[model samples]
Target: MAKPRIFEKPMGVRDFLPEFVSKKKWVEKQVEDCFRSWGYREVITPTLEYFDTVGKASAIEEEKLFKLLDGQGRTLVLRPDQTTPISRVVSTLMKEEPFPIRLCYHSNVFRAQEREAGRNAEFFQSGVELVGDHSPEADAEVVALAVEAMKACGVQNIQVAVGHIRLLNALLEHVVQEPEMIAKLKQSLGRRNLVEFRESVQSLNGSDKKQMVLSLLTMKGGQERLDQLAKMDGGKQVAEEVTHLKAMWHALEDWGVASRVVLDLSLVGSLDYYTGVYFEGYGSEGYYLLSGGRYDRLLEQFDRPASARGFALKTDRLVMASTQGPDHPERVALVYSRNMRYEAFQIANRMRRQGKAVSLFVKESDRSFDSLAGYDRVEEVIGDGNL
Candidate 1:
């Protein structure tokens, strides 16, 4: 029989090598510490859920999901986003737990699209959700958590751009009460196209509110610009959301982290679920490092509706932004003599217990100690005698 060819991995997917593992774990630890301190208990959901179940409230368009059949001949698919599965867990599994469930999760998500510099078809995300509350303070807390998480990872030269979905929602309410009009406006917002948006509003005879909305599309930097915007808009919901956004902004100011924030009212999220404040973080590379917002209606689909807000930072991009190519942490090496094979295992276990990176190397017939140079550190010799 002829041998079958071994094809390369599909594009947009990657395998993490040992050198990347150390830094990846370091990033996870930072996120875990930040989330735990904020009272968010960690939870996990399966990597694959029934195609329909995971896609029910997913942000991914139906056409973009990667699907397959399970052993039982049932349709199944990889999760496209973490929050939806987490929401399902809270709603269906832990329904009676309590109000304002503070849950955190770290998982891989898959989609079926060609990834580019700013996009990925498969990626890792770490985030927390605060369910059952809708206060501006809760919103601020989520935003702050994202900022703190990035800072923990040694990330700098980044800005968290904040916006309110309500502002655009309100404008849609005023201009095009038609479903078609709303959908078209959403499409424009997703692309951030000022020209098309202007023509669309003009077609609807939108003058005052349209102009205001268009102006928001151009407000792209700093707090003073956001304050100027808040003073212009007025309406019950618009005014309330503005008040909430300002409060959140001032909270950032109080934390002395306001310099790293930018107000972007036109920053519409691609997800259909975000019904309140929306945000995305960008580094100097001009790429989104993290993206999330308020999805208050997400849990309701699972029959346990509640006000919820949170954000997820893309861990892979985080590694890219925070670690320079040559500076990524190297793997560890543990070398031992023939008589100390068992001791080598003991030492590696002890180092792991103390949260240190470790890899064991038992004495071999051919390779010399010079091979240890490949790793960041090495335990040269386990003494012949035990303590």
Candidate 2:
């Protein structure tokens, strides 16, 4: 006889039990409700897309993508991010639509992560994109919506750290002239390695520029930090970026979420498409629950350039942080003898119509009454139609 073969799921991938799936679905519904209430209509994009199209709009390296060749030899990839694919859809298909299009989605995104990190190879993301709007109000509106989404998930101790890529780019323009050197400086700052960042700044041409860059790496707080940055020596562009950020801060305050907002100049988004204000929400549990920013140039890649901003919440992380288990709905199991099958089903249907979960069980099978110990109620159907 041949040996039996065992099958297993790939690394960094997960299989959710019923309880976990229930909690995840609950979280998704909450987030989707929040998005819909804000006038964001749901959109669904393909799980696989042309590598060329997705690659052009995103900063994800090719190595991290799960690539495959179709029968016609065309290269395709599992989408690593939702924003790029959605951008392609809007730019090419919905070109004639009205501006400031609001679209939302709940989907699974695939990415390669280190095995030891215990991260999922596939993860759920729920987000919304506000396209064709570049005003400070748009930026503030997205951030405020992110706050509300987190609240809907029952996530507490949330902090949405806001930063402007323009401010960082403006400072770099004054200090670092070499593209490679600028890239290195950004990498160092992104890693929070102040030592490397300081060393890189030391090579700059001017003390004032070096001081400004160093100050920015540590500048994080509330409106006071913005006030201090406004007085820095980053010239015209930096001043404008700072002014824009201050305006966004006021807008966030107007939305009544100023208390949850924090100013963090050192905060840089992982993607390069972000052009202006970017923010990421962190929970007290130390998980990054949400991330978003303005990607004004992203649509240009698809031949329909327009200003856009959005955020994607990590639904798995939110569920893990907020829920203990499935918390399944109130359920009753209706057991029936052979003669009472019809009555048992009728009762089950009636209970279901009354907004209760009912599980039907026939007697003398593998499943016994003991198997229904978890149910809220277990009723035996008698031939006389009485429990």
Candidate 3:
């Protein structure tokens, strides 16, 4: 007879061992505590949702969704993002809730990332959604909360790169009338491809438009950059947007996180649903830790058109960036012979009551006590009932 084969776990999936799980839980607790302190309540949504519902509002590509068919012949997908599903819940279920509903969630999302992307197919996300408020204060509150969450995770040397989608949209609307051309321009800008962006803008109506497009590609810094943008033609056209950004800056200052903020106008978000200010947080080690922005129109797909903004922290990446290590519990190994089994149980119970982690072992096993490497101390129950 042929030997049985052991099947391996599916690719892009991971089995988190206890040590890693402990660290992840620690990070989650810190984030949840911070969210609670800020008046955001925890909410949970289904892992599987209708493809049509999620696809209508999310920017995830159809091919990248983990899709299936329900018993009723309806299409279903493992949620590729949380914000859309949460929006569906709020719009359909919590429609009557008070204005500016604050919700926070810690859940895993599924995405079929390309193999070369080196990203897991399933990863955890911790985030918040501030619904029904359109003010610049809402935007600033989300950003500030993101910063606090990062600090809570023990991440240092953080920088929050703030940008306005309206700034880029305004510039594109001014230079390119054709939707196709504008999309190409945005694609180039999103990739930070200056040469390609410059080429795309070369067909613009005048040198002024081309220069403005080229300038925005590199226009990122502190208050000076904002001042310079305000003086430009593109910036002047969207003066109201600039004012909103300024108000957000002031709010960040009021939160005492202004020193960590930088104005990076070229920082366009990947999601098409974003309608206004968007920001991404980075750590000193060159990892993108968090990203979010205002998506005012997303809820309209569910018939609840309200202004909302929020951000999600990539928990997997955050574990890599966190300075804290996994907690090591002090463990005691309780060894026993068959005759001393009851005595061993009593000793273990006593140890447990004393708050010690006890690992019970039988001396009859082929393995020796030394084989248990992680235990800090090993006690053997002898025939005399003495440890």
TM-score of each prediction: 0.82, 0.93, 0.92
Candidate 3 versus the native: TM-score? 0.92
User: In candidate 2, what are the lDDT values of residues 1-387, reduced to their tens digit?
Assistant: 655456567778888898778889888888888999999999999999998789545767777788889999999999898999899989878989989899999999998877687878899999999999878999999999999998888887889998888888887776665778789888886777889988988987778768767887678888898888788776899899988889989999899999999988788876366889889998877878999999898889888889999999998889977733344667998888988888888888888988789998888867547779989999899876789
Best-matching candidate per TM-score: 2
Residues 36-96, model 1: lDDT tens digits: 9889999989888887777867877887788888888988878888888988898888888
lDDT of 3: 0.85
Better of 2 and 3 by TM-score: 2
lDDT of 2 at 116: 85
Candidate 2 regions with alpha-carbon error over 4 angstroms: 1-7, 114-117, 175-180, 202-210, 323-327, 365-368
| lDDT against true structure, model 2 | 0.86
Residue 109 shift from truth in candidate 1, angstroms: 1.2
